[model samples]
Target: MWPADIEATARAIIADFTARGLKVATAESCTGGLIAAALTEIAGSSSVVDRGFVTYSNEAKIEMLGVEAATLAAHGAVSRETAAEMAKGALARSGADLAIAVTGIAGPSGGSAEKPVGLVHLAAAGRRGKFVHREMRYGDIGRDAVRLATVRTALGLLGEISQEP
Candidate 1:
C-alpha cells in the first residue's frame, strides 16, 4: 500500500492522464518498482500505465531499456545522463505518451567519494517533445526514506511531463 499523499498524487495523475488520454511508463533503478507499484495500486490505473521497467542492474538497464553501456560506464548508474536515457528508452519501447526514469544511490552503505547515498536523479519525457530532469541529494537518509522520496519525485516528474502540449 502507498501513503495517503502518495496515493492521492497517484490517483490525481491517473485521473489527469486518463482524461488527457495519455499513458505512462516507468524505468526505475534505486527505487526499484516502487514508482510503478504506487500507480498500479490505484483502481483503473491499467488504462494509463503502459508498463514499467525495473532495471535495477546495468544489464537490465541495457537489455530492458536500452541504456547504453557507454553511458553507464562513463556516468555510473546514479546519474542524470543515465536517468534521461532511461526515460527516453522507455518512451521508445512502450506505447505510453510519457515516461519517467529514476536512478539513485539509496542506502545505508553504498556511498562513495563522489556519489553518496540518497543521491537520486530523475527524468521524464513526453511525446510532445517535453523533457524534465532533477537531481535530489537527500543526504544519507535511511534506505526506506530515500526510496520513498524517490518514488515521490519520480511521480512528480511524470505528472509534470504529462501536462505538456
Candidate 2:
C-alpha cells in the first residue's frame, strides 16, 4: 500500500542489498515503522531486511534501541544525536550489516519555536564505522506528507550506505 516512487525505491534497495549479500534494519520514531514497511513491501525483502524497531517513544527508544537516557535528556529525541545513537543501536542489535534510524515531529501540532512540526532527523550506520546523517525541515507539512518524505529520505540513506565502497 505504498506509492509508486516509494515502491520502486524499495524494490531497488532489495535488489541492491540482495546482490551485495547485505541485510538492513530500521529504528523508527515519528515515522513509526514506515521505513521498514517500505523495504519489506518489496518481494524477497526478507533476504535483505533483518528487523525493524518501532520505537515511537522515549522509553521505547531507550529500551528497544538502547538510546542513552542522557542523550535524550540533553538533546531530546528528535535531535541528530538521538538519531545517530538509534542507528548505531539498531546496527548493534540486529544481524544486519547496515541500519537506518529516523526521529521527527510529524504533525499539524507539536510545533515549537525551536523544533517545529515536520522537523526530521535521520541517520544511517554501517559496518566498519560507516555513518551518515541528515536533517530536514519540511515546515508545517501535514503529518502524512512529512512521514512519507522521511520514509523516502531514509530509504535513500540505506541505498547510499549499501553502495559505499
Best by TM-score: 2
lDDT of 1 by residue, 92-139 (tens): 999999999999889898889799888999999987779999999998
Q: Quote the lDDT for 34 in model 1.
A: 92
TM-score per prediction, in order, is: 0.97, 0.98
* lDDT for each residue of candidate 2 in 118-144, tens digit (9 for 90 to 100): 999999999879999999999887999
What is the lDDT for 28 in model 1? 91
Clashes of each: 0, 0
Off by over 4 Å in 1: none
The CA lDDT at 67 in model 2 is 97
